[model samples]
Target: MDAETLEIRTIEVTPNAAGDASTLPDLLAQVPADERITRVGGDGAYDTSKCRAAIAARGADAVIPMRRGGQPWTTDAPGVDARNETLRAMKRLGRTIWKEWSGYHRRSLIETKMRCFKLLGERVASRSFDRQITELKVRAAVLNCFSQIATPHTIRVA
Candidate 1:
């Protein structure tokens, strides 16, 4: 989701067998290479090495929270530094303060968008997987249109 527009920029529908975190890389890949991604925010489920690496590859800060009782990655990997720093900060400032400082609460915007998407329908009407993917994409487009329409316009008077 694009934070500024609150629109789904990329959509990938996977089978029920696939984990949500596993799709993070593909979603990032779908983004145009030239586009500048400043930050990627997600839940603790996205705290995996692969997800972190993908976000780092895009030159974006990962706003994913560490898992409960999670330890620092043992390997001196490329992405571990940022995760370790987050861990240290979380330990020092406490989770609530760290989250506020990191702007992690922006994740709630994504959650609200999902709730609006669910309002369209809880389940896809299509029976086949291919059709289901198309259905979901169409729904996302509708939501994006709704977002564009609902956005308020303002002007400077002074």
Candidate 2:
């Protein structure tokens, strides 16, 4: 998702049991190559080396939290190394403060969309895989339209 625009740039529908870390590469691949991505923020599940590598390849910072006792991968990717440094700083600054400083809270934009989806309908109306995919795409489009119309734009003079 584009944090600034609050737009869903990519969506990968995976099975319920699929690990987020394992699916990072597929999701990252969906991001357009031309897009200028500065940082990729995710929850602790995305702190693995593969995800870090993909983020580094895009020349972006991985604003993901390390798991408990999670050590940095021994590699030369600057972004990965920077993530490790962030882990160290997290220990000093505390996770909550670090999240505030790093703009991790913006991740809630996607969460808000999820909430909207749930509010609109909790269950998939279509049972078939292909039909379900089409249904979700249409639902996302409808949600985006609703968001565009309902979201108030405010200009800050400060």
Candidate 3:
């Protein structure tokens, strides 16, 4: 990210975040239990009951994929092997809607939001961690406070 007021700062490298239930709990401890988290999308990495419980505790609707050797989300659904085969052969236009399709559609929306936040908010190229967080919060607060000024209908440049 770009530095403060476009000022450059020394970078500090941290270890890659760890995985597993214990790791998740420790890392997310700062997040309040009552915070209204809507949805959490995760991969096979989140398999343990503790992971699920922790997410659900935040009142979030989790969309984590059940890991291999773990309980299936739906017993009637075909195996991953078959699903992979279908995904490889089918095109988006003619293919039937499936679980992967749902995930892709939803994930794309999230990607768009992040891209907009990065571009319009000048948040993508941050100088440091604290600056990055500040930029995001500042952008959101500014937008909320001056929503009408930002809206196309009310914007009349003199």
Q: What count of clashes does model 3 give?
A: 4
Model 3 lDDT per residue over 1-158, tens place: 11111111112223347444455545344555554556555455754556566665665554544444443233233233323343343333333353455453465554444454456654246778677656666664543344435435546799
| Model 2 steric clash total | 0
Model 2 bad stretches (over 4 Å): 155-158
lDDT of 2 by residue, 47-71 (tens): 8777888888888888888788877
lDDT (Cα, tens digit) per residue for candidate 1, span 1-158? 99888999999899889998999999999999999999999999999999998998899999988999979888866679999999999999999999999999998988999999999999999999999999999999999999999999899899
Q: State which candidate has the highest TM-score.
A: 1
Worst 10 residues of 3 by lDDT: 1-10
Q: Point out where model 3 deviates above 4 Å.
A: 1-38, 43-50, 67-104, 121-128, 140-158
List the candidate 1 regions with Cα displacement exceeding 4 Å.
none
Q: lDDT winner among the candidates? A: 1
Per-residue lDDT, model 1, residue 140, is 97
User: Which ranking of candidates, highest TM-score first?
Assistant: 1, 2, 3
lDDT of each: 0.93, 0.80, 0.45
Residue pairs with backbone atoms closer than 3 Å in model 3 (clashes): 1-125, 1-126, 2-125, 4-7
Every model's TM-score: 0.97, 0.87, 0.40
TM-score of 2: 0.87
For each predicted model, how many residue pairs clash, with residues at least 3 apart or on different chains?
0, 0, 4
